[model samples]
Target: MKKITIIASLLALSATTFAQTWSVDKAHARLGYSIKHMTLSDSEGNFKAYDAKITATKPDFSDAKFDISIDVASLNTENDMRDKHLKSADFFDVEKYPTITFKSTSFKKVNGNQYKLVGDLTFHGVTKQVMLNAVYNGTQENPQSKKLVAGFTITGAFKRKDFGFATEAPATMLGEDVNLRASGEFVKE
Candidate 1:
């Protein structure tokens, strides 16, 4: 009986000290991107529907894993015609590739509150390794929900041609580089 009680206590303690899972608060998150248009202006857009989760064993999140998926059809740039064109065969071809996903390979601390996130990004029927700069915006307890939450801002850039995305578009019409930015609050799960 005594041994059983001790074992149970240890298990409880380990559970609290081990890996923790966190889910993004969709209402407080944004997945956005920007690209040069006509070599003159920048066109910006965002995916309204997406999901992300994080797993971490360290308090500082130095050993964290991240997974995210974005609904390709949920993209919006506030211009219906342009958005439709972007979803067509000239670009994303949403019907063929309905989602864009990323799974982290490594998360290494670069400096105070900064980290390098290396991951495999699958987009437009292609997968490639990419690195993003991450800033850990810290954690806090929600005043109303009383749950622990963490904040992060991740940014990266990739060439559209590299992913076979709208490869036919000339640089004079649409720039090749796509800049990505995601920021959000994640709730402990």
Candidate 2:
């Protein structure tokens, strides 16, 4: 009877593990980023097209995995002429490299509701691994839309020169670092 009880407990634990997997809707990813402008302000932009595959459960994300991609050509800054210039060879060079991608290498829980996400970021024909310190702003059941909603604020920085974005506009001001800040959300379908 003791041996039978042990087997039963093990089975119960296995069932709990099987129930922990969760899949978020790929269409619900909100991706945006900001870069310093003229060393005085920040210029914000977001890609309107992208995809994500996230597997995570509420409260505990140890088993979670995340993958994200952004279309370089879909970059929009709310100005038509400026947008076209940005898409040219001097900037993103979207014609040569069409997509920017991120594949997670590792993630670790920080303090409350936060995780340090380390991933590879590819842009402008360059691939560099970066870390996104993100805060998990809790998941909620939307009252109006009736879907699981999750939000995150990811703050990080990268040097513009690393990806061949060495614009002399900053050199005129004797500035070298191009800080970046990205924040967004994800929802369950």
Candidate 3:
């Protein structure tokens, strides 16, 4: 019994040692989106405020879990009038839904530096499962900060109407699909 207890304690210690927490380097990250407008051109925008974090036990981050939250009021399309309209009840309804959040359920390795990320996304007061293609851009030491950091890029698309956003807009006025692209560098904490 004494020998068994000793082995169990060592195992627990090893597991704890491998676990790591990574925090987003906000200045090195961005969350942006694009959607077709007027059935002609694509309108692009990005959120100015957001937070993201990752937790992993593997060196390759194959078992990483991600959590992210975006401030809806921080949305900007470079057009003041359009930005205001988007924040109103006609679109995002920022008063009712102040934020959008995502929590990863699975992060599966696909090929070299490629992964499939599945998660639950809560947007516009509705929650739904979403999948995104993730690319592990590798890890390296930041020259200035002298810290270990990991880089990643994630992309996906979902229907705006599915999230109860801009439901009244016609197809000719605004496309149903919203394309998302986010990239960030995370520093081990």
Candidate 4:
């Protein structure tokens, strides 16, 4: 009986110390991208709907699991015609592929607050491994909800041609590089 009690107490302690889940605060997050338009200037757009599921074993976010998804139909370039064109078969083909998703395979700390997040990104019927340079923007207790929250900013660039997004638009019309920037905040659950 004494041995059983000791084992139970140890198990309880471990669970409290290591098990934690964090959920993305969608209201405070933004996923956006910028690309050169016709070699003239950069055009920026954002997705209106997205969500994230994050699990962390450490407060500094080391050895964390991250998954995020963005609604392809929610993409907006601020122009009605342009937005529709982007969602058509030429671009995202939202009717066929409705969401762009990422599932982290690894997270490695690169210095103080910087980390490299390696993940499988799926979009437009293609899946590829990508890496994002991430900066942990620190964490604090939210004054409104009184919950512990952490924020991160991540950036990466990829070639549109690599994902089969190049067939419709020529290089002269749309730049090959598509740059992404995301700011996400997760509240400890």
TM-score for every candidate vs. truth? 0.91, 0.76, 0.93, 0.90
Q: How many backbone clashes does candidate 2 have?
A: 0
CA lDDT, candidate 1, residue 89: 81
Over 4 Å off in model 4, which ranges? 1-17
lDDT of each: 0.95, 0.70, 0.95, 0.90
Residues 1-189, candidate 4: write the lDDT tens digits: 999999999999996789578888888998999988899999899999888877877878898888998999999989999999899998888999999999999989999999999999998889999999999999999999999999999999988888888477887789899999999898999
**What TM-score does candidate 4 reach?**
0.90
Tens-digit lDDT string for candidate 3 (9-110)? 999999989989999998999999999999899999999999999999999999999999999999999999999998999988999999999999999999
As a TM-score, model 2 comes out at 0.76
lDDT of 1 at 3: 100
- The per-prediction tally of clashing pairs is 0, 0, 0, 0
lDDT of 3 at 80: 100
Model 4, position 157, has a per-residue lDDT of: 94
Model 4, residue 125: what's the lDDT? 82
Q: Model 1, 2-76: lDDT tens per residue?
A: 999999999999976799999999989999999999999999999999999999989999999999999999999
**What is residue 188's positional error in candidate 1, in angstroms?**
0.3
Span of ten consecutive residues with least summed lDDT in model 3: 162-171
Clashing pairs in 4: none
Model 2 over residues 87-141: C-alpha lDDT tens digits?
Answer: 9887777899899888878778888888898889887888998887877777788
- How good is model 3 by TM-score? 0.93
